[model samples]
Structures are given as C-alpha cells and as structure tokens.
Target: MPDTSLPKTAADGDAGQGGGPVPRSTALVLLLLVILLWGVNWPVMKEVVGHMPPLTFAASRLLLGALSLLAFAAATRQLRVPHRGDLPLLLSVGFMQMTVFTLLVTVAVQHVPAGRAGILAYTTPLWVVPLALVFLGERVGWLKALGLLVGLAGVLVLFNPSAFDWAAPPVLLGNGLLMLAALIWAVNIVHVRAHRWIGTPLTLAPWQMGMAALLATAVALALEDVSRIDWSGHLVVLLVYNGPIATAFCFWAMVTVNRALPAITTSLAMLGVPVVGLVVSALWLGEPLTLTNLAGLGLIGAGLAAVALADTRRA
Candidate 1:
C-alpha cells in the first residue's frame, strides 16, 4: 500500500503536470481497486512464503514488479533516469521503504497472522508523526497529537497481555519486525515530504523499484536457499498477482488517485486496506478474529481518520 504521508506536491494536486485530472468517479474506482489488490495481497504473500523462502519470494516479486513498472513507464512515455539531485531521496526510499520494509513484512508474515500484520504494517502514518516532528521540524498540532495517542492505544490493545502471547518468541519476533517495517516506511514518508520534486513519484518509481530489486536479489542470493522454491502453478499465479497487479498496478492507481482526489480523501480511503485484509484473512485462511482485534481495528480507523483530517486542515 502507498504511504499515508503524501508529498506536499502530490497533496497539493499535481494532476495538471503530466495529464489532465482524472474524473472523480474514475479515480474512486481506481482507488477501490488499489485497496482490494493491496489488502488481499497480505494473505497472498503469507501463502507465498509458506511455499518458498521469504527473501527469495520477495526478491522474485521485486524483480518482476520492477520490470512491470518500467514497462508501464516506458509505454506512457514517462520513463527516464532520475535527476542527479533526486538520487538521495531515491536511495533512501529504495533501500529503506521498498527493500528492507518489504523484506521484514514478508518474513514476519510467516509467523504473524496476515490480518494483524496488515494493521501493524500500515501503522506507518502513526510513526510518521514523531519522525516528522524530528526530521521535518513540523509541529504537532493537537489534532495530530490526539490521533497519535489514539492510534498507539490501538496498538497496545493489539498487544494486550490477556490477548497476545508475549511468551512466544516467534510471535514477538514477527510483531517486532512489522513495527520496524512501519517505522522504516515512516522515515521514507518524511524524506518524501522534505524532498524537492525533481521528478514526480510516479516518474521515479521504476528507478527506485529497480534499485530495490537489485538489492533484494543480492540479499536473497547470499542468505536464502533458492532451491527450496516450489516451481508450481500456484506459485506462478501468486507471483503474477504480486508483481503486475499488487505492486505495479496498485502503485500506479494510487498515484492516479492522489493526483485526482483530495489528499484527505485519499488517506482516509486507504484505511480500508487493513479492514479488507482482516476480512479476507478470516474468510480465506480461516483465521479467527477476536474481540480484541475488532476493538483495535476500530480505534485504528478512528485514529487514522482524525490524522487525515488534521493533515488536510494543516495544509
């Protein structure tokens, strides 16, 4: 899923830059598709790793997704190497957000339930509040502060001693890794906010994806047993979904929606991702949803809505 901390330029509407603004109806449809693809992908990735090593599966999908994005960029005549000045932001996003964050989520999903993993991973915006205060010198308005506290309360609820198994090493490791992934993504979002636009995020995405692909591949080769990969039809189907649909199409759709819709609308709507993930995981994987999970999800949605509204008001 795309970050909640949208760049200033994108938030302010860059629709006129490349092409005319998309129709609101069209943009909403695209946004819904993005939500479905990304939300369902949590369970998809969870299943993928069950059949192969996490890093290797991550590496393969990254490579294919990078290529697919490149093709999209080229077909649209938007393909170009990033400007020299964009390298710093590019490297930061590529390594921290795309590679490391993805690796952590992929690995952690092996031990964590996909529903809960989705909630934890998408907490990137909550982390962004603190990171932005430090890195961007942004003030914490009361609305945002309240939102942060509420969101964090939801996080604590998810980890409540009565509901969570704190004694399980695998559970602890998975939850910890997901939190780290959220923080890493938050850092990328702050950098995105601070970056001067040498290229629109869409224009630069393929390059960043390429870098991530290369780095993930190197790591996977060094650490993972590639031979363990099951070359089955199911694996192929899953990879196709991850590469072209989830990664490539969803990113493109999100950018389109960002340009067409108001920032607050986009951010608020994106919260549906974890909700969808939760429902899909329960139905598809037979993962039981507890009362604690429902309560936490409600609080998280409220918190995220408050934050999105606050951001729009601040803007």
Candidate 2:
C-alpha cells in the first residue's frame, strides 16, 4: 500500500473525488493493462531479435526507450541530473536492471523461445525470497520455504536431460544467461528496497535508461557489424511497441500502480505476465509447447503464488 502519509494529490486517481484512493475497479484495469504490455513484449522482442543481431537489437531498444523516458522527463520538468551521491545508485540499478538484464535476454532469446525465456526471467521474483532472508534478515515462513523448493524443482525440470540438448552451446548459454539475468534482477530488487529516494523515481528513470543504452551501444559496436541490420515493416512495429508502449509507458504505469494498490496485491496480480507471455509466444512465435515445459511453468506459478500469499499475510 502507498504510505497513507503521502499527500492526497500523490495518492488520488483521476476518478477519485476529494483526493482519495483509486477505486479498486479502476486500479484492477490499470494493473491488467500493464501486465499485458509486459507479456506481449516478450514475443515482440523474440521476433525482432530473429532478424536483427541480438546486441544491436538490444542497443536500439534501450536507446529508443531512453529517448522516450527523456521526452517524458522534459515534458514534466523532471529533466535534471541526479545528485552526485546518487550516481552510485544510478550505476548499480541501471547496470543490473536495464543494461545487463536486457543484453542477456536479447542474446538468450536467440536460443530459447520467447515463452521459456519469459518464464525463466520472471523467476526473478522467486529468487527474491532467499535474498531477502539473507540480506534483509527477513524470516521465511513454511509456505514460502516450500514454495522456494518447488521453484527449484521447476528449474530442474527446465534442464531435464532427456529433453534438453545440453551439448548445444546456444542452448546451454541461453539458459545460463537467463538464470544470470534473473539473479541480477533479484539483486537489483533488493537494492531498490534499500535505496533512499532523493527525488521522484520517474526523474531518475530516464538517466538510468540512458546509461543502459550507452553501455549496450558500446558493446554492440565493439562486437557487432551494425551495417547488417536493416529496416522493415516488422522492425518499425517492434520499435514503437517495445520502446514507447512497453518500456516507457509501462514503467510509468508501474509507478502509479505502486501508489494505488497494496504492494503484495500488486505483485500477485502482475504474475499474470509470464503466463500471458507463454501463451502469446506460442501463438505469435510458434514456439512449440512441450509437456515438460508446461509442467515446469505450472510448478513455478504455484511457487510464486504461495510465496505471494505468504508475503501478503506477513505484510
């Protein structure tokens, strides 16, 4: 839940009268829309990366996303640099959340289908429970502990030797990178909890995105031949949808959702993202569905649900 102590203007929604909380009905709609934006982008990224080199694609998406964020910041007069002390926070959060995570997923998706990559990446939430226990000294209840175990089993399922081709370098690297992306994202989530806010987070977002874009571009230029990338109808669609709608606007929606709903409630509701990602990938990318993958997905979803339930009760 938002701090009740926040000013009414900060907490009120468009439909609210006298600066009150958003109606649950309105908040629910906003949550679903954000989830859809996140879920659908998986296939969009997969499709774009199919034709474009992964690093180049990653750099372009982050650059366009950075531009979109900067435009929003400028429009709202939030376009100043962060204080010098906050530079470290910028580096840590920006590196893990945007740069490293995006680059890994871009490469990872070249081998893993969009659906599998989405599931593996969303494991970020599952990884958070243990990190919280260790770093924040938060106690895990029996439910959360068991949920974590089930999640571990799901990871095992993904690497089932009978089905998975471990000898294939791309296959191995893809899964490994996805797991690394999840772990680093988990680290960033914990860091976010420990950060002391100096300004509205939205103000810092453009800078963080810019940092990611610059780093990705540097890497892409050093390793990739950019001249091979070509423009297309599909590429045009991908740039608009992924950069502006999915990355920029969805982030804005997330910030508002945080103020409008309970923290645990929001997390639980957003779990719909990976599920939608899996389905859309199958439909759009023609990613084959194996029984093993479905079983793994089910276990992961169950674990996340259990953890969310325990977290909700604890909160």
Candidate 3:
C-alpha cells in the first residue's frame, strides 16, 4: 500500500525525474487485473477466516507474501536495507498498511458479509480525498468533490439500514472496524507518498511485508487460538492464494501501476473491486445480488471515472 505523505509536488517530481508515464492502455489493463484479484480477495478472505482464527490467518498471509517479495527482491537485485532515518517510517507503514489493516479486515469479515466488507473497504478513496487536501495540499475541485459525495452515497446504499440491530453486535463492530481499517490504510498511503523511499519497489515491498509478517505472527501467538488451525487442504490453498497472489503480486502490480498512472487513475481503477466482489459473492458464496447493489456499483464507478478523467485532464 502506498502512503499519502508525498506532496503532489514530490510525486510530480518523481514522475518527471523517474521514468515518464507508461501508456494509458497498459496502465488501465494492469489496474483492471489488480482490481480483479483484489475484488476476489474479499470472498477468499472470508472463506479462509471462517476456518482459521483471524490473526493467525493474517499472520500466515503476511508471512507468505513476505517470503514471495523477499525472493523477488533477491532475484531482481533490489534488496537494500533501509537507512536509519527510513526505518521508523517503513515500520509504521508495515504496521498500518499490512499488519493492522489485514488483521482488522480478517476479523471484520467474520461479522459482515464479504460483499459488504468489500464495498466498505473501497471507500478508502473517499477518505483519501479529504486527507490529501489537508495534508498534501492537493486541491479538490468541484468535480472531485462531487465524485466524493456520490461515492459516499454508494456506500450508504450498501450499508444495511438495520445495522444497529441489538442482536448483531459482531456485525456492527465489524463494520466499524472495517471503516477504521480504511482510515489506517489512507494514512499509510499518505505516509508513503510523503517519504519516497530510495529503494526500488522490490526492496521496499519485502521489508514492509516481512515486518508485517513478524508483527502479525507475534500478535497471533499472543491473542489467537493458534492450536485450533485445521491444517487442511482448504487452509493451505487459501494461504497460498492470499499470500503469493493477493498480497505479493497485487502489491507489486499496484506499485507498478501507480508509478505509471496518477494516483487518481489508480484509485479509479480500484472502483471495479466492489463490482467484482459482488459477482464473486453471488457466484461463489450465493449472496443475494440485488438491483440496488448493482446501481450503487454503477454510481461508484462513474464517480471514480470522473475523478480519474479530471485528473488526467489536469495532468
């Protein structure tokens, strides 16, 4: 997960000084693939968490992702240890982006439906708009502001009106935690943007993943029922898919795409996730596929596209 810390000026500098923009078609396709993998992530995570304790599942995924990134970094010769000044920022990013965010989402899935969780999580972009304006001094024009409003409306459509029902404490708590997780993720993005790492994506990713894995493992050992793991084929599959494909590959793809495209475009592409997640839920989990949900998805997509198009024009 990228941080929000980098000023627009810095990002502009990086884009100008680093490699120039990749082709729009290429960035779009890569982001679409990234969204698909991430969309399916909700259902996959929900299924895995059903059998394993949340923290343990999180730890396993992080560990697998870390290993994959480490191997890639080694093979690519991008393995550089962070300087002393960067250590604290890297560790903070690992905790907020990988460890806490993953753990919270895993636990939240236990309380809410995967589709609902997916929609809520994608609201990260909505939160990011305000944060970016305040911290990065990124101006939010009328169109972007409208996009934010429309996106939040979509979230409202997804939210179950009876969420406050007394019998569904877990569901309510899970929903709240998911929102908090989004905030943490947004903060991590800002942090990353603020402190542009000198290391390449290959090097930085492994460091973050490894730190997340270690921290998650420690928490899992302390708080979760580690002995209750089933060690079944399903569990193994989930770990492998979530770790190598979802975490490692997804992270790498996201970094590459973000480097190629503007932040707005990258965020826009992620709007496909809720749609994909809803489809996965309907097909795989037999969740109800209502017209309202579909309509909300459309609205969200339009809003995201508007933002992306506006950003592209500005650029």
Candidate 4:
C-alpha cells in the first residue's frame, strides 16, 4: 500500500518545487487523506485477502496501481524512462520496495492479524537507521542511537515470547515475513536517499511500479491460484481503493505533503498511520487490542519520530 508511509526528504523538492506553497488547511486535509486511505486499507487488505488469494490480490493491485500512476504521469507530461546506468538501481528498488514488500505482506496478513501486520511493516524506519549508517555513509548521533534502541525495543515487545506462540509455525512465518518486508523497504529507502537523482520521484514512480507489476504477476501465476477470487462489486471497489487510491494517490499525497509541510512534521505525521491501522482494525475487523500492542506501537511511533528528526538534522 505504498509503504503507507512518508519518505524522509526535504532534499527532493520536485513535487512542489515550482508550484509555490500549498495552503496549510488544504495540506492538512490531504495529509489526513493519506493516513486514512492507507491506515484503513490494512483492514480492507485483510478482508479482501479473505475473499481471494493474497498473491492474486497483490498482483491485481500492482497491475492496476501501475496503470493508474502511468495515466497520471502521461497527463502531467512527466512520463519518461530512466537512463541506462539507472536501470539496475531502478530495478532493485522497484523489486524490493514494490514487489517483495507486497508479496511478503500478502503472505504475512494470512497468518497475522492485519493490525499487527501493518505495525510490523511500518517498522521500516527502524531498519533504515542501521542500513543507512552502513551503506550510505550516514552518521547516527546519540539521539538516533536512542531512537534505534527504542524502535527495536518496540519490535521486541510485539515479538514477546510470553504472548506470541513460538511453537506455532504461522506465528513465526507471519512475523518473519512482515519484518523482512520492512527491512526490504528500508534498504530501498536508503538507496533512494543516497542516489543522485536522475529524475524526480514522481517521474520515476510509475516506471518502477510498472516493472513491479510485471514481477508480481509472474510470481502470482507461478505460485498462486488466480481463480480463487470471488469476483463482485465489492472486490472491484476494494481493488480500486487498494490500487489507485491507496497506492498511487497516496504517493501523490506524499509528494504534495512533503513539499507543503516541514520534513520532520511530515515524518512525524506518518507515525500516526499505524495507530489508525490498529484502531480501524479493532473497530472494523474486530481485531483485539492488547496492552503490549499499544505500548509497542507508541514506542515505535516515538522512535520513528526521533529518527525522522535526526535525519532532518543530518540533512
């Protein structure tokens, strides 16, 4: 669902670079849309996955999401392919961020509650700190180090041995996949932050999404029974919501909001996504909320804020 997260960048300013500033009221509204569409999608993703194979659902969303973004790109005259040297980075980022994350989370939600799955997936910022330190030559000061600790501690809380069934294969499988998904996205984010931009984020978005769609569809065909989907109006609505609204429009909103708001403000706002996911899942899907989950989410969100603020200072 588009990381269902905000990117850490005040450096890449192409989204609103020349458009002038957006009104605060308008920007705030758009930011809410970003959180609501993505946060709500966790439960929606869970429900739709119940009606169809996860891989099939993921594949369909990727295909449609790519198409929707492509349409936007065409209309905006931002459609273009990357340079030859950019291919590897583009493919690698696209595969991990778009395909791998989606595939892993698709499988994960089958075994874990969607609320929990969403929290695990959003732990991506935690991975970014270490990976960026190693690969991007980014420095981690004391604050970020504290952030890293707090974030990992939250992850540990979620993985509490007393509460989680270590003996259950589904539990291990689901948690492992979700964490891996976050790690994969974190790696991508580091690469994105490190890369010398040959194109704007919006310009690169559709191509990467299109490439990911092909890869996901290939995997879905190889491993999943596509015929399992119970086709109906409900399915189409979910597909549209998950595809265009959640993925493409969410990206659009991120670009706009990132431009309109301070980078740290945007990053901090993103931390609310998981809370919304948790609450929506509780109300809509009836997923039980536990003290541990609540505490873990709070710590992770705080940790993420620390990291985002640290990155802002670094930038």
In terms of TM-score, the best-performing candidate is 3
lDDT by residue for model 4 over 222-305, one digit each (tens)? 998898889899888999989998877775565556445443344445555777888899999988878987897778778767
* lDDT (0 to 1) per candidate: 0.75, 0.71, 0.74, 0.72
- Specify the highest-lDDT model's number: 1
* Clashes by residue pair, model 2: none
- Model 1 residue 195 CA deviation (Å) reads 0.3
Total backbone collisions, model 4: 0
Please state the error at residue 267 of candidate 3 in Å: 4.1
Q: Worst lDDT window (10 residues) for model 3?
A: 12-21
Give all TM-scores, in the order shown. Answer: 0.81, 0.80, 0.87, 0.80
Worst 10 residues of 2 by lDDT: 1-10
lDDT of 1: 0.75
Of candidates 4 and 1, the better by TM-score: 1
Q: Model 3, 180: alpha-carbon shift in Å?
A: 0.5
For 162-211, candidate 2 gives per-residue lDDT tens digits of 76688999999998998898788677655544444454456678888898
Worst 10 residues of 1 by lDDT: 10-19
